[model samples]
Target: EAATATATAAAGDDGGGAWRVVGGDASADGGESPTRGDASRLSRAVDVWSLGCVLYGVLDADEHPYGSWFEREVNVINGKRNLDRIKHLPEAHALITALIEEAPTARPSAVEALEHPFFWPDARRLQFIQEVSDRLDKITVDNPMLDSLEGRSSAVFGHRGWQVVLKPSLLEDAGKHRYYRPHSVRDLLRLIRNKRHHYRELAKPLQLELGDNAGAFYRYFAHPSRFPGLLMAVYAFATEYLAHEPLFAGYLGPETARRYAADAKERCASAGASEEDMLAAEEAARAAALLSGDTLQETRREWFPREDAWGDAARFSVSSAAAAREAAGALGSAAGLPPVGGPAGAAAA
Candidate 1:
């Protein structure tokens, strides 16, 4: 009887048994599977897939990832996993998805899998951000890496930028730094980079002040869900700017960084070195004109003949006091409050 059964199995006859072994070369969705002799299919990636299935089962009430037993083998072969139940858990979902990628070569190694953001602590995440910021400080403005960082930061944090998202007190403290500039995300990162670089060299009193002020900054990252893109953006920024392999590439994917690099290269090729120099010269000229109070209606037309007229706009000035008053007035107006020195403001105070 045993010899007869073995011969029947070898002849592809399961006899309707519920526990029959499914061959690895099972096809699904009319797609061809790897031949039985293909040794490339047998790899650590198989273990990664198994690990993913186990994790999915553990997270989803011990249920099989591919479905019922009868369909499980087919679904696994087709790379059709039912992750609906655990989809709400972004980090876990991401890790599992990468682990079970259809292409065996696409799956992360065991060590890379362990480094996923899903496994990171809040402290480590913060440290990661600090390290990236430090690395970015060494990059020049002309580097495409800064452009990539700026683009990603804008997408994650918004065009209003990181300054607006941070606490008012923290912003104020940042302004006091020698390298302070509130114009862009690059400026904010540079400020942090400079402060952090000299932090240990500072006096104890200054160090404590810096730490106390940065408490809210740290708290900002404590609840990442509130800022969904914060960690991913930082990770992407690091991957591109620091020339480091992505730690959370499985989450955000490495395609974005590659696309940015490609786009940057294309733009440079199309613009050529002479065009870039000309553009830079024009920008410097505009800045010089604005600072020299030469952007008045008549002067602007004279200096930048192709540019539009200021059209009765107020004269542009670099006067600090005037800029402060203008900013204060704008804030007061937006809040429906009177100017700072007015009777209504005094009474409200």
Candidate 2:
């Protein structure tokens, strides 16, 4: 019976009893996990691929490892994967790449996969990220309030062509006419750091008379070690952090830091600030926009996905990945995934 099953598993019809993953876009989907490989088939390679998908989910934070189910299938059919997203973690990229090789014969068996070196923790890798984070933390700039950073315009950016709006959840009826990619921990850390720079304009008012150590918390944003109490504030009250940046952009801090802080508070109050961050501090508020120079956090490119201006109804469907793949090879390629055959030493590939 075992021998019979083993021989039959390899050449099953194109999708005969083959498991199919089912789900929606996960970047902004907030609910139960939106993707899973159905176990309708008994192929060992299928099991291995499923394992790889699950692992991808685990590591990529809230992101669907290969995006939606249809996206994963198209990649599988073409011997490709969104491995570039995982490339940051070399071990994960290698293991998943191997496990999902298009050829069943090329994939590792369950026993073989469990023992792969990628599973082992690499202290060197940890240290390297630490080094990167540390180096990035030391970076400094002048007058973030005066800077003109270009980013995916927020909801506050005035619902123009494809703005990147951050909302809490994705209800089925909600108009999700947008493309999204989940942010990484490093990205969050970078945001924290940027907030310290740009959002600190709000905090500028009270820095002086507050105390000698008033602005001491300025630079300690997201260092791997010695993370400050302010981090918890950012984490716990993140909604405020999200709201402040967009609203502050509307204000021009032309007067004293105190005056600017006061003016900013009234303006931001209309923009929905929680009044927890810079607006709450007198000195920080006063300094919010004293700069006649470049305003904070300006950039040339938008980092996150913007709203799809067309807002085509088809773009938001669960079946859309396959449809898009079949149409213009759009979804996965548009996803910016790395090409296949990354890393080395799989159970087979």
TM-score of each: 0.46, 0.25
In the range 235-285, model 1's lDDT, one tens digit per residue, is: 655544332224323333355334344543454334332223334434433
Full-model lDDT, candidate 1: 0.50
> Candidate 2: where are CA atoms >4 Å away?
1-42, 121-349
Give per-residue CA lDDT, model 2, range 87-136, as digits (tens).
54544666777776656556667755654435423332232223333322
Q: After superposition, how far is residue 109 of candidate 2 from its true place, in Å?
A: 2.0
**Looking at candidate 1, what is the lDDT of residue 261?**
48
> How does residue 82 of candidate 2 score in lDDT?
68
Best by lDDT: 1
RMSD of 2: 26.2
Cα-lDDT of candidate 2:
0.34
> At residue 121, what lDDT does model 1 achieve?
67
- Superpose all Cα atoms of candidate 1 onto the true structure and report the RMSD in Å to 1 decimal: 14.2
Highest TM-score scorer: 1
